[model samples]
Target: MADSDGEFHADDASDDLEDHRVTTSSKHDTRSRSRPEKAKKGTRKSGKAAWEDIQRSWDAVVEDADGSLTAAIEGRAEAEKRARLLRDTTPLQRGIIRHLVLVVDMSFAMLEKDMLPSRYELTIAYASQFVREYFEQNPISQLAVVGMRDGVAIRISDMSGNPAEHLEKLQGWVKQEPQGNPSLQNALEMCRGALFHTPSHGTREVVIIYGALMSSDPGDIHETITSLVHDRIRVSIVGLAAQVAICDELCTKTNGGDTSSYTIAIDEDHFRSLLLEVTTPPVTRTQEQSNASLLMMGFPSRTLAAGDSIHYCSCHNRPTKEGYKCTRCKSRVCRLPAECPGCGLTLILSTHLARSYHHLFPLRNWVDVPWAEAKRSKACYSCLTAFPEVPRTESGKGKTPEKGKGKNNSGSVPTPLKGLSESGRYACEVCRNHFCIDCDLFAHEVLHNCPGCQSDTRGAQRQNGKATSNGDANGAMEIDS
Candidate 1:
């Protein structure tokens, strides 16, 4: 009996030992699973801390930088970048000419002093600049001017390539005080008539610099907009004061419901920029426009003044010593870019022909290089002036100075150089050479040749061969090849 009791006690002890083993294994499994979770939590915390540090560093850098010119430069850079992207996607068709009419509002509203020195004066100033830039950018495009006042729209200047004539007419007209309401409808009708005579190969556009909030229309403007759309005429409006519903509707209908065709100018600079953008080639709307057509042009040589023979000019119908004679009909005229009074052929100056070539070969936008990335040259490539050091902030970091801050003790901003911001130093994309702003403008405008490009042997040879022929003392005419 004692041996059997001992055996039962041994069995119970073995069962209790097995149960302890199972409980210990379960606890070990739980601890192993929790180890991975803790490690993941620690990694996430470290990543968040690193990101916060980077953000703080970026904030400090921006805070220590100049804010005034930075915004303007950044804005312009972003706009240029965006424009390049759009240009890459959209291909421009060759031999596409434009006929543009500028309609200026000469109503009483233009006399308002909201735009500083009066809206009329400011408009004229920007308009003059726009005319010069337009001819520079779009050499083949023809321009005309119209004025609306006293409920009537009058043609100020005939369509011509010479911007000087347009400026003269505009200046003479502005001398009189602005009066009466603006008749936009009349202006549109007159412009349509002017553009209707142009060839179908060219795109017709009208730009209206309107100041008044209301337009005095003699007829239904909606019908006029539909007619313009049907005729493939694109109309753009630049409002000086406020946006009008009629202008918006006209732009929308003419541009195929694209609302971006209209814009309101915020300031003088913005206004000038927007006006210049209109000089870009417009995208052809029809497939039929792909076929090229010959346009009749006559290059008239300048005839020197031999003596006072009382020769009458066909354009002004007055006696003049020096006048241009049409190559086609040999008819005498007062100025160029005029239709020959005898043969009705298009007459243009030699400079007009030379300027048109720029559209085919446009100057590339200069690249803005960082001071560190720029070559260690002491002087500018074009101007040969010493490079100015980058302005530093209290934090020992480089900062661009504001525009007007570089004035002398006389409270006058410095001439010529003005003030150079960090973005002002531009490097030629082809030659990788740096130049100042004044040099860049002179190279593109006056010289019409990149200084770096002109230095190349091949470029010099080409320039010599195609050197811009001087305009005749009177004017030279162009004949379609």
Candidate 2:
């Protein structure tokens, strides 16, 4: 019995040991699962912190990009404003009254779509603007339109001071499809015939808008050029494509070796600008004999169209109530500066006489001021833009150090104005007004009148036939009193 009792105790001991081992294994399993979950939570926290940092950095980058874009936009706006002001304020000169013929190319080459919306379309639009501007600027000047198509030149509109008539004819004729190669010689010959009847007192100018590189001629172009030169007729050609040899020769011969008379259009904008230049009066050739002739002009009065008792126009030789009656001949006419059909007297307007007087008194050219002199102003005299700052060298701050053995280093060295090379200025000799390079160019070319001079009463002195003693024949002005 004692032996059996001892065995039972041992069995119970074994069962207790097994239960202890099971409890230990269960605890180990739970600890292992909890450790893995804790590690995953730590990894998620690190990833979230990293994402927050990336988000902050992205926001900073966006802010910097916005600021840079805004600054660039503002800079461009200021530049455009400066350009606009320069264009609008430029003055115009009242040049001599001229008789001009505008020859446009309606050839197949003009239909090329190189200039956006075809060259023909662009030419037509520009030509219309040119006619309007020409008539508006030169109210007294007579303009005729000639179109070249299918190697034949024809008169689209007769010489007329009325812009409406010319514009109407141009728009109607220019819409047609381009035909064959342009005949430049035929166009010039047609212009010569129309200008032949014009009085010698007024200058005769032929402005050809040539598109084709080659010119189809019926006769020798050299002979035509010779005739034009002898007649004192100046021919200026504005080429649309590359330069042509014949057109260049024509301009040189007629203009007495002046190369500026012929210009090849660089772009659409340049083409329009060149055409507008033709409206200005041509400079008289100094080498040619000045056959100044006195022209007989009669100021005609406009007769009322109401209750016309069978009044007929001397020009059209047709019955018309709305017409001008010549003061000398007492004959009705359609327009001014026309030779009366009833009588051989020249009928003209008072404005025509005023326009011709500009040749007697021409405007003076402005001289360029050096950077050394221009740097005196902190801002541009005309535009008021801040003057460019001078660059600093490693040795000297803003001053250009003096060289040579006798240079004194003891005293305070003077600092030269910055941006001497970049900042260029112009001073009008007559008015003594300072201007930037852009303003200077605009004043000379487009405005033709100095803004400073215009502000003073001296501008009217030219019109009053009173010569300023301060100026020389070469347009140099004397020192200001």
Candidate 3:
């Protein structure tokens, strides 16, 4: 009600008090209205988004007290195995000369015992293994490690191609316990600062084995990520916990929208798998680097002249008897595949380049051998590991058949004489020889050269063009060698 002077007074109300307040019926109606909303909210917060993936293996399963797999978890293992079989093997130009910074989170969250021993201990163990695997896969690549704790980034080791130095650094931290919170921004900033001056020809990468759900960042993480992208640094993260939005966005954007760059480990074994996955050289991005850029590298040779005086090593200011003399600076280096301390020239062995070349033109995948022909084989052509005999089927064949007389495409011994293992066998298309599972994996993964193809004499005969027959007995008996 308005007064005569238009002043509103609390005492001059004509409305009933009951109309201004909620009655018992209104309270009941309000509860009734929010019931459906509450139910929907509960259903929406089902926590599916936090689910971590199980290891993609058939043997990765929970076992009962009797050592038998429970029926409930069998289907999950099969699903993971199916997922592993769907990987893409298409060839791409990957960066072999990589300089990577491995950042291991040393936050309090790492003390959790969900992982064996503890997350921190297991992570360090895996980190050591990752160092070895990284060098093994990327032989010419250099690696450094960074530890993040108490909102500070500390360098564990400097960028070096020697795995022993990195291992020694990791081994020294056995007594050091994890403490404080992880700072993603500080860690990224540190990695960026260290890798900023790397040569544009090689890949610059950051691999973080983060174990925390939340990061105690001092500043905007987005700014650090922008700097990384501008500097062409590829960021890869393997999380011990569920996915974090900031990490997802960081990896996705830095890797140019690839979701495979980030992963969350379900268990310790799965965590190892995820970390080892980073050992493989990442495919190079054209926009991030120039393809036509030229780089000069030195292949250091270990040579010493008689009565030559020993000189101090450039790598370490220590006296050395003999070392690889740098071609550019003429200073002695203690090791190969290192940047010369005096000249900054990339010093490496010719073998390292050959080791790195396999990734560029890898051997083709071999096909699985047929059961009928595989069972007749006696051993591997290379290793000669005896293969288990195939069981006789009830269709009436009971005895082991004689070895086949036919030779392989290499024009040597009959392939069936080579024993095939029980784990099944693979046949090389070019060599037409059977190899057991282990040998097959080695041929394709490590030893890119095929033994059968290398041992064949037809290639030598074709190169020499069948020597003309000599009338003399001594000349006729002369060997090609």
Return the TM-score for each candidate structure: 0.67, 0.59, 0.72
Regions of candidate 3 where Cα sits further than 4 Å from its true position: 1-88, 288-290, 304-310, 390-423, 461-481
Q: Which clashing pairs does model 1 show?
A: 298-478, 299-477, 299-478, 300-477
Ranking by lDDT: 3, 1, 2
**In angstroms, how far off is 37's CA in candidate 3?**
36
For candidate 3, write residues 1-481 as lDDT tens digits: 6678998766546344455555666988899988864433323365433323434546444444456655326334433433332345567788888999999999899999999899999988999999988887788899999999998998999889999999999999867899999999999998988897788778999999988999998888888889888888889999988889999999999999999989999987799888988877788777546476667888767966458677788887887777898887787888777888888888887667778877766667666676467755768888998754554443465543333322332222222212332225667788788776667656765687678776655533222564323222224332221
Local error of candidate 3 at residue 443 (angstroms): 2.4
Query: What is each predicted model's overall lDDT from 0 to 1?
Result: 0.72, 0.69, 0.75
What are the per-residue Cα lDDT tens digits for candidate 1 across 46-88?
Answer: 6554344554423322211334345444434544443332233
Give me the overall lDDT of model 1: 0.72
Tens-digit per-residue lDDT, 1-481, candidate 2: 1265564566767888999999999999999978865534424556554344554423422211234444234334444434333332223332365789999899989988888798999998999999977865566678999999888898999987778788889879755998898887789889999999876566799999888988788888888899998887899989989988888889999988999999998889788888987776666654322545465556777777777477777676787768787676677887765667777776766655554543345445555554346446666666776544322333645444342111222222222122212234556777777776567556655565677776565533453576543333335432211
Where model 2 places Cα greater than 4 Å from the true spot, the runs are: 1-95, 286-291, 301-323, 334-339, 355-481
Model 1 ranges off by over 4 Å: 1-91, 94-96, 136-140, 161-164, 307-310, 389-425, 444-448, 458-481
RMSD (Cα, Å) of model 1: 13.8
Which window of ten consecutive residues has the lowest lDDT sum in model 3? 409-418
